[model samples]
Target: MTFVVVQNSNNDTMTRRELHQAWGTQKEKLKLKFAALTDTDLLYPEGMETEMISKLALKLGKTKEEVYQIIKAI
Candidate 1:
């Protein structure tokens, strides 16, 4: 599952489908927001989220946590 973010004080969270239901929007926003990002960088194959984030962190010169926060915020 593609985890989006933690929801609230209740500690509930949602996956890509359950939450935004519009990863396309967020993906577009992400590419626009970070010009360095490419479509390949956003690719999320099954069970590859960590690798994807690691790649993003390396490309953007940010920590994984920062990358996660950026994604979550979008």
Candidate 2:
């Protein structure tokens, strides 16, 4: 699948669409990456990327950047 990359205010390069797409395609891998994460945790509400990051950060004990990197890697 194709992805569009965008730079955020902090100059972090992330693929917003691809992040969600990868979450769909790589759910099992992500669960392995963050054992504490659940299926509900992966759900992405529209325009709730920050909320998703916060949830993941809390669940995974990771920084937002780290979570973003993990998602980007997927």
Candidate 3:
């Protein structure tokens, strides 16, 4: 099962699908950004930071693996 949460400008929450769609967009962007880096680049801490990846996982209320798979599909 999948779950999602969305907050509107007025702080109203959206449905799971709605939040997932929004996360899908962000995951696509993250995929692009992640793919643009070289393996070496990803290895270096100062350059390709994985912090945002972690943060994104938390922000989207999804697991790291879930976010990772999303990025892969994009």
Query: Highest TM-score among the candidates is held by which one?
Result: 2
* TM-score for each candidate, following the candidate numbering: 0.69, 0.72, 0.36
Off by over 4 Å in 2: 1-10
Residue 1 lDDT in candidate 3: 41
| Candidate 2, 10-55: lDDT as tens digits | 6777666756655676667788876777899888865577888889
Error of 1 at 55 (Å): 0.6
Which candidate achieves the best lDDT against the true structure? 2
**Candidate 1 lDDT over residue span 42-61, tens digit each:** 87664555677789899999
The clash number for model 1 is: 0
| Error in Å for residue 7 of model 2 | 4.3
Clash counts per candidate, in order, are: 0, 0, 0
Model 2 steric clash pairs = none
Note each model's CA RMSD in angstroms. 4.3, 3.5, 11.3
Q: Clashing pairs in model 3?
A: none
Worst 10-residue lDDT window, candidate 1: 5-14
* Candidate number with the higher lDDT (2 or 3): 2
